[model samples]
Target: MATYSSNDFRPGLKIMFEGEPYAIESSEFVKPGKGQAFARVKMRRLLTGSRVEKTFKSTDSAEGADVVDTNLNYLYNDGEFYHFMHPESFEQFPVEEKTVSDAAKWLQDNAECIVTLWNGRPIAVQPPNFIEAEVVETDPGLKGDTAGTGGKPAKLSTGAVVKVPLFVQEGEVVKVDTRSGEYVSRVK
Candidate 1:
């Protein structure tokens, strides 16, 4: 594995710490008036999503994690594991439910997603930033109520609930932000 020096400490960099893989969320350089320079890094554990902070001296270094992200097509979930396949290679694998919890809500059959692997095992999954899903259920929109006002909860085809504008109706398609799980706009 390659090593990353303090100079390489930056967000999105994956490094190994105490036998676990961590993604650096933020890194700030701190130099005291009389001491050497150091880096304060906030990292999130790839496997658990827990965050932690650590300081490293300018001379300190960390091993780069053996992590890779590959695009895969989602197949289905059997109540226990989610299955995915590589489009070209046709390689398939079952990722644990816990590993894909954050992304499960936005997943749709045949959708392309990025799977993050560490040491040949999946540790995280990321859906597309934006997704268009059909509304499956919601209360009727009131007269004169528009999207600019308060929103209501609507269930989507993927079984995820998102707050959408009053004008959005059942069977209508709405764009959503996967990262924040918020409604973006109604699709025409």
Candidate 2:
């Protein structure tokens, strides 16, 4: 364990406090007009998915826990584990459905991204920032209506739906903002 001053704290830095693991969310150094500077920190509890805020003297030190992250390629899912292979070493690992959550459903086969590990086990996955998936289905455009004010629903190959311009049609490959589940632009 390493002691890190509040000044050393940064987002995604993992620390152990009271036998639980937490990662820093945000930290701000506040200088009160009459008092010493302190660090206001927000942290996310890894086990419970809860957030906590606390203030510490700027020089206060805490035990820093070790966490690891690696860039990898999503190979495929086995219905149980979403498998990933490291880009450099080709070492592979899998995280289960619950851990990947809705992100797994958003991933296409062989996608490249990052995965975080704690104590040599997968804890979270960072999927690709964006993806281009073909629209599999949607209501047909109104016949000759020419009124484009309203948008139609488009379903992507990942089974996620987005409101697209009236002109988007089935089989069109559209760039998707995976984080927001929104269509960005038509690929072609």
Cα distance off (Å), candidate 2, residue 42: 1.8
User: Could you tell me the lDDT of residue 22 within candidate 1?
Assistant: 97
Q: Tens digits of per-residue lDDT for model 2 on 1-188?
A: 88889988889788886676788999988898997889899998765567999888987888886667788888888888889998889899988777777677578888887777878787777778899999899888877856655688888888788888878889999997888877789997
TM-score of each: 0.95, 0.84
Tell me the TM-score of model 2: 0.84
Which candidate leads in lDDT? 1
User: Per-residue CA lDDT of candidate 1, range 127-186, in tens?
Assistant: 988999999999999987764657899999988999988878999999999989999998
What is the lDDT, from 0 to 100, of the residue 100 in candidate 1? 95
| Per-candidate RMSD, Å | 1.6, 2.6
Each model's C-alpha lDDT?
A: 0.93, 0.82
Q: Report the Cα lDDT for residue 13, model 1.
A: 95
